[model samples]
Target: MKLTVLVDNNTYIDQYYAGEPAVSYYIEIDDLKILFDTGYSHIFIKNAVSMGIDLNAVTHIVLSHGHNDHSRGLKYLREQYALPNARLVAHPLCFRPKSYENEYIGAPFSLEEINRLFCYQPAEAPVFLSENCIFLGQIPELYSFEKRKAIGTTIIDGAEREDLCLDDSALVCRTDQGLFIVTGCSHSGICSITDHARKVCQDQRITGIIGGFHLFDTDSKLEETIRFLSDLSPDMLYPCHCVSLKAKAQMLKYMDIEEVGVGLTIQL
Candidate 1:
């Protein structure tokens, strides 16, 4: 499997790619071309083009969650690089109205609009995009310290309720060494997502993990996360996006974190 960072919060000094406070990865596994998250705008598309990646060739689009930073680019994709045959995968509730601090943070397009753009595959269970790549649907919060906390609110059946980020998910790539987990802002808790990926893939060895851990503050949760990841001992860790400098500093104390930026690529 080969993965390319199309959009990230940071850009390499000489890479010359556009950077945004968002996340998007272009992954190629076997004959499948998968796009994980879309970032906040059409910037991902522009970066992919610069990298010689053809967005129209994407076979599947997997959304990590319903947050604006992750799903907003779908609108640009639909408007410009329309892939009518591509499969759009996400949790059922990912399209529900989401708000943070009384401001809209959910997907810009409605479910009805999305259905017209791609072959919608709303999954509540693990869905395989390829023989080795699987979408971990609705991660289970198994860790005592990594409990789900309300990020905002979402409307369900016309009733507003705490948005526990039930839609938060991750993409697991089963490599020869172990699983390579890719995530968006891990609102479901990075440990919970990794644990769920292990359970779903039946592989205890995690080779590496890339993408936002959502550890922006130094708290018990961040401390617990550092502890959990230390024990897991993945070969490489790329914590970016929603992760703050303080959190990264604490994480660096426990594990060797690889630098992540736009134009970065990894092979497994």
Candidate 2:
């Protein structure tokens, strides 16, 4: 499996690509071309074009969550390519209206609008995309240190309540070495996500992890995360997007956290 960073919060010094406070990854597993989490705008599309990735050929568009930073680009993708055949995969609640501090933070497109453009697959269970790739749905918050946190409020059946981001998910790829977990925001705790992936895939060895860890501070959570990751001992780490510099610095003290950017690519 191969993964390309189509859109991220940073770009390499010499790489000529747009950077945004978002996440989007173009993954090629087996014969399938999968797009994981469209970024904030057309920036993902523009970066894809720069990398010579054909968005029209994407077979699957998987959303990590309902957050705008991750799903907003779906609108631009539909307007630009209109990939009628690509499957749109996400949790059932991913389209529900969500607000953070009185500002919209949910997916820009409604369920009705999404159905018109692509084959909608609302998965509450793990869905296999290819022989090696699988989408981990509704990660369980099993770890005590990684406590469940609410990002904002979400409307369900016309009632507004705290959004613990039940719609958040991740993608896992089984390679010869181990599993490579791809995530966005990780509203579901990163360790919890990995643990769920291990349970679902029945594999404990993780080769690498890429995308937003949603770690902004070097607090207890970050320390616990470091401990967990240290125990897991993954071959590579590319923490970006919502991860802050201080958290990265803390991670670097214990593990080799690789650099991530818009034009970066990884093969496993």
The 0-to-1 C-alpha lDDT of every candidate, in the order given, reads 0.92, 0.92
lDDT of 2 by residue, 1-268 (tens): 9999999988899889999999999999998899999999999999999889999899999999999999999889988997778999999999999999999999998888877767999999999888789999888888887777888899988899999899999999999999999999888899999999998999888999998999998899999999999999999988999999999999999989999998898987
Q: What is the C-alpha local distance difference test score of candidate 2?
A: 0.92
The Cα error of candidate 1 at residue 79, in Å, is: 1.2
Worst lDDT run of 10 residues, candidate 2, spans: 109-118
Stretches > 4 Å off in candidate 2: none
Give the C-alpha lDDT of model 1: 0.92
Q: In terms of TM-score, how similar is model 2 to the real structure?
A: 0.98
